[model samples]
Target chain A: MSAERLLWYTAVMAGVTYLIRVLPLVLFRREIKSPFVKSFLYYIPYAVLGAMTIPAVFSATRSLVSACVGLAVAVIMAWHRKGLLPVAIAACAAVFVTEWLMRML
Target chain B: MNAAERRQAFKTGFFDGLPIGLGYISVSFTFGMMAVEKGMPAWAAILISFTNLTSAGQFAGLDVIAASGSMIEMALVQLVINLRYALMSLSWSQRLGPEFNLIKRMIIAYADTDEVFAVSSARAVGGKRLRFIYMVGLMIMPVIGWTGGTVIGALASAILPDAVRSALGLAIYGMFIAIIVPPARDHRSVAVVVLSAVAASCLFHFAPVLKRLSTGFVIIICGIGASALGAWLFPVPEPDCKPPDLEERSAHEC
Candidate 1:
């Protein structure tokens, strides 16, 4: 793509993104009426997180295995309500160790 | 919320964003590396990371750059990948003080990353004001980490060993886990998480129809469809509380 085209594309996407993000705030104001919409909205984060993570973690790729281990440990830590830092550290350690172990095995 | 309490919301939002910043170092590093690999300038990669504060959009944008797509294509890609932020921003604005004018709205909108949105949303439900302090509350460390990562990624592409770089790449996926699994314990949310992912994977892998579609198009279809369906399936009960605001009326109530 031409430089001009790329910049234009970026600008337009930025606008759409900003608009989409800001519009509901502008339009809805305080009225998120449908309990269904509210409930569904709650799940968007999970849905995005899950769909994004799983494929990365379990696919037939090396990093994926480490990612799974790190994630599993992180979940356990968070479920127990550990601080975010420890969970993140332990999970990252899990990935590093898993990768190292795979190399040894 | 009083002065002290409003201050506490900033603390909550800030710390909530803290741990995740660690994971960003590696991911943004790779993103910067990849962006440069695709001929995006070092400064451009860093700028994108700093401004967008998103993983999915940057990744898709990188692909768009790789494809040498038209400017329209690039923007559409960003729009599709980032559509979720709209929902997040909407949920947050309601929690803002009525005094919040255009400027405050603009600041919060710029800082609305996934972690910020998540933490701010939680506090907002309690009807506490976090968005005002919310930008300063959550964004400083992350902005530093992301920008730093990109700088290193761009400069270190040749020096970093492939195996080590590849290993570190796993950190991004790990970060996603930190973001996802803890929240999935709730059943209604869990089902949404599982199905949406399964659907994204299946649609991408099996649906020859989608193969021709751009990354931007695919994400929009998946995100909108999954979110809409999940909403249809399990709705949250409306809170039965007096006055949506969470600040105690009496000075002693807090």
Candidate 2:
């Protein structure tokens, strides 16, 4: 992509994200009232993360098996409520080891 | 706040943000490598991190840019993926100190990321209003970590071994799992919502007709659909007591 186009897209993303973050802080000082809206907002992050992780995660590494192993390690560490850094490092280590073993075999 | 007090607040916020900054280094390092691997120039990848300061949204946005998706698609993808910031902003706005004017609010909003929001919210939870200097103090380290790490990652991508580079591709997804899994484990509603999203995403990925849709659309559809369903099926119950106003909340804590 051209530098101009990349910058344009980046600006669009930054603009929308900024609008989302800033508008509420400036204008919506009142507490939100609706239960359903609150619930929906509460779940959006999880849902988005979930959707983004799957299928893509399974292909993130050099091989599907290694990726699957990485995912398993990540899920286990995360289930234990490990910090993001630890979980990420463990997952990467798992994939690295799995792929090494596969190469040796 | 007095000048001395402002300096102290900035120092405290800086230390508080240090750990989050440390964490961002690792995640954004992976982001930098992935962005370059996807054919972005080192500078351009770093530019995205500097400007966006969001993990998922930047990664998703990178995908759209790489795929040459429409501007509309990029905008919609970011709007959906980063919508949580809006909710966090709204929740935290009520806790802002009287001195937080329009300009300060706008500046703080730029750094209203998930980790930053978490730490700031905790500071405000006892009814103490958030301070402008403290918030700025809290954000500076993480911003440096995020941008600096990306610069290193983008530059190092060329020198890193292929095996190492490929393995690191899983890092962002690992971070994503770290974000969602604990919440899902604790809350059945969250678990249901996450699983439903994964299922929907798989359908879009593997289903012949649906697979034709771009990744940006897939994320938007699956995210909105699953979260909306979760809300319908498991609406968060209202607080038992009347939620106290900001002053009342502080008074009760005191």
Candidate 3:
């Protein structure tokens, strides 16, 4: 992409994103009182994060099998309430080792 | 807020945000590499990260840019993929204290990524409202880490071995899991909501018509659908008596 075109792309992307984020924060000044609305808002994080994580994680790595192994390790570590860095490191390590083994085979 | 309290909130938020910063580094690194691979200049990649902190939105935008898609297409894609942040920001609006003015709201809203929102909304900094100073503290490291990673990845994508880069890509997902798992384990409602989202995502990915939808639209549908279902199934009981702390609120609902 040309520099001008890239600049426009980035600018538009940034503007749209910023508008989405800021509009709600600025408009809704009062505490939300509706239970259903509150509950829906409460669940947004889990739903969005879950939707973003799955299937995508499987495709992030070079091999699906290694990705699965990495995911398993990540889930296990997370289940045990491990910190973020440790779980990430363990998952990365798992993928590394699994990929190495597969290559050897 | 008092000066001492403001300092404390900032300190606490900064510390809480450190891990998220680390996670952002790995994730944005992949983004930078992908941008360069698609023929974008290194500076443009960094500029993308600097200007737009969103992960999925940027990725989708990159695809559109590479296709030489129209500006309207790019705007629509970003709007859809990032619509969830609007919901998140709305939720956060209620959490902000009276102290948060328009300027502060706009500034803090800029850094309201998924992880940042998850951490900030879950934990009560001082009282009934989210501390503005604390949020500033939380944003500092992630911004640095994200921009720093993009610069490195864009400049050095060729030199980094595929093995290491691929492995590092897992960090973003790992961070997502880390954010959700604890709350899921603690609250049944959260767990069910997460499962519902996963199911909806799978349906969108595999089903015939739904599979044709863009990723941004699919995520929007899944996120809203699952959350609405969760809300219907498990509505918070009277809002008046609810605890200020979200973690406590979940436990109380249970």
**Top candidate (DockQ):** 3
Residues B166-235, model 3: lDDT tens digits? 7777766776787678768866878899998998898888888888887767778888999999889988
Candidate 1 regions exceeding 4 Å error are A1-16, A59-62, B63-68, B94-99, B122-131, B158-183, B186-230, B240-254
Give me the candidate number with maximum lDDT: 3
**Lowest-lDDT window of 10 residues in candidate 3 chain B?**
B245-254
| Top of the candidates by TM-score | 3
The candidates, ranked best first by DockQ, are: 3, 2, 1
User: Which of candidates 1 and 2 is the stronger one according to DockQ?
Assistant: 2
What does candidate 3's lDDT look like per residue over A1-105, in tens digits? 588998999999999999999999998887777788887877787898899787688898899999899899988888887766678778888888899899899
Judging by lDDT, tell me the better candidate of 2 and 3.
Answer: 3
Give the lDDT of residue B86 in candidate 3. Answer: 86
Mark the regions of model 2 whose C-alpha exceeds 4 Å error after superposition: A1-13, B1-45, B54-104, B112-146, B153-156, B240-254
Sorting all predicted structures by lDDT, with the top scorer first, yields 3, 2, 1
Candidate 3 deviates by what RMSD?
3.6
If ranked by TM-score, best first, what sequence of candidates would result? 3, 1, 2
TM-score, cand. 1: 0.77
Candidate 2 similarity to native, TM-score: 0.68
